[model samples]
Target: MCNDSKIHGFLEKLPKCEHHVHLEGCLTPELMFTLAARNGIKLPDPETRPEFSSAESLYTRYENFTSLDDFLSYYFIGMSVLKQQDDYEALAWEYFQKANADGVHHAEVFFDPQEHINRGVLYDTVVSGFTAGCRRAEKEYGMTTKLILCFVKHLPASDASKVFDLAVERGDFDSGVVHGIGASSSEVGPPKDMFKEIYATAHSKGIQRTAHAGEEGDPSYISAALDAYKSQRIDHGIRLIDSPSLMERIVKDEILLTVCPVSNVKLRCFDHISQVPIRRFLDAGVKFSINSDDPAYFGGFILHNYCAVQEAFGLSIADWRLIALNSIEGSWIEQERKLELLKLVDEHIDKHLAD
Candidate 1:
């Protein structure tokens, strides 16, 4: 989407912080097939599920997602290949490698613990693998990383709480192995406040909170998440633009909306990238970050989302700077890392402007 070479380079070099990406969502078709064979997992037959016939076929199917649920059906099947600690580590490390190349300086990635646990995978297996991937990013790229363990909302709140309690018992929050807690999946039917107990526990424990809100639902979902769950940040908060009052409240709170441009388009949330309200958010002074919610499934990574935003709205350098800075500020990082990323944003802008 970024046809202009100058702007493309500028977007590429700007340090980014990804706040909405799902580690499970990062499993590409190639890797999924590889993992399936390695783990002795048998995929559905092509006669029954033609999309799984080949990795290329699945890639083609991903190009036309009918709805969030449609994509999710395939999403769950894809992650079934991830059974071992190494599988999870590979999945996350692959994502980190792609993110690092996209100039992501800090990443707060989401992992669905309830889903894995439901499939009989150990919680330790999932967390340890992802943490290993995060560690690799730190060692090789010197990048800062944090993990957000997301609870699946479609399951009973009790299910989510069980996983949340397990995470707490493991000291995931206190030790920073898991920096936060969040809710995700099937956003429409499940009210955002369904996990009130879990979010309350998280808030009580000083763990950061965020949730998937207003993606497939209305602005009320976003408001409920903020008022009920006390979410510190919002994932896929695109619909908040429709509710001026909610938008104002989010602005007042300095909460960040992790907007995934390409995912919205690919998920059939919008017909095209131009309709995503990137420009509207900018004009309204909404603090938002462009991200890749699920790069493998959504057809693009963080930089691609940035390019799509740039192409859709033709944002100015200052607009880009504001986005990058807001992402840095919204990150669940130590104050020192936040300042470091902030400075990098300014220096990047200055150096590019001078050039």
Candidate 2:
């Protein structure tokens, strides 16, 4: 964003909290091949899907994504290789290392259990591996993590309900193995209230909730998530700008919007990073956190997302401080942990801008 090394250093050191990154989305092409070969899984022939030939070729294909569904096609292909608990653990550890290097102190990650269940991978395998990775992150990097089991919305609600029942049977929410639930994938076609009953159950039990809204869909998608799903946070609510009243309501309620800059441009939601409306949201008093929704596919990680926003908007120190605070506030962590993050931000502000 700035030529000044001091400002750049400050951005690098800022503690980040990502709420929208999907664990499966972090499956890099290199890892996919390793796991595929280890598990004896067959990838599509090179003639039909040339991207399967090599990691380099697959990454080249990632650069030309035309839409969310287009990227998802490749995303699911990458997940085919993750056949064992170790594979899932490796995938999360890989992402956690990168996140730690980028200064992430806390994270609420998303994973689709239904997708894995359909693949014949047991739910316990997925949770244990990811949970193991999270524990390692906490021990080694001192970073806390919360897992959010996301439902593949394009799948039948009956499928999701079944998964929900399994989660309840396992006491996933009550025991905190999974912190919450969210709806994702194919946002446009799914009925807005498809997960209403599930949300009602979660709300009745006082569990946390969130959803992907207003990213590929319209502002009404965001409203439905609130009115119907009663989500505490809105993931990718960039389209909230289209509805003034919705924007007002969001500000009044202090609902956090997890906005992904590079993902939006890659998915063609916006033509360029500059079109992401960073300054608009800041000026309008809308609380939002910059994230890399699917960094492996979208071409950047959390720091890369932060750099893109800064390069586009040249936001001042106060602006960045606010953004960092907004992210911390939106994090579904304990109040004591939230206070610690706030203290870190204050230290960074003093160290970086003390000149």
Residue 291, model 1: Cα distance from true site in angstroms: 0.7
Task: List residue ranges in candidate 2 displaced over 4 A.
Answer: 1-3
My TM-score estimates for the predictions, one after another, are 0.98, 0.98
User: Model 1: per-residue lDDT, tens digit, 1-355?
Assistant: 4899999999998999999999989999999999999989998998988988898899999998998989888888899999999999999999999999999999999999888898899999999999999999999999999999898877888888888888889888889999998888898887669999888878888889999999989999998889899998889899987899988998888889989989998988899999998988888888998889889998889999999888888899988888888888888888998988889889999999999
lDDT of each: 0.90, 0.91
Each model's backbone clash number? 0, 0
| Angstrom error at residue 130, model 1 | 0.6
How far off is residue 134 in model 1, in Å? 0.5
The total number of steric clashes, by the backbone 3 Å criterion, in model 1 comes to 0
Model 2 lDDT per residue over 104-213, tens place:
99999999989989989999999999999999999999999999989888789999999998999999999999999999998888797899999999899988999999
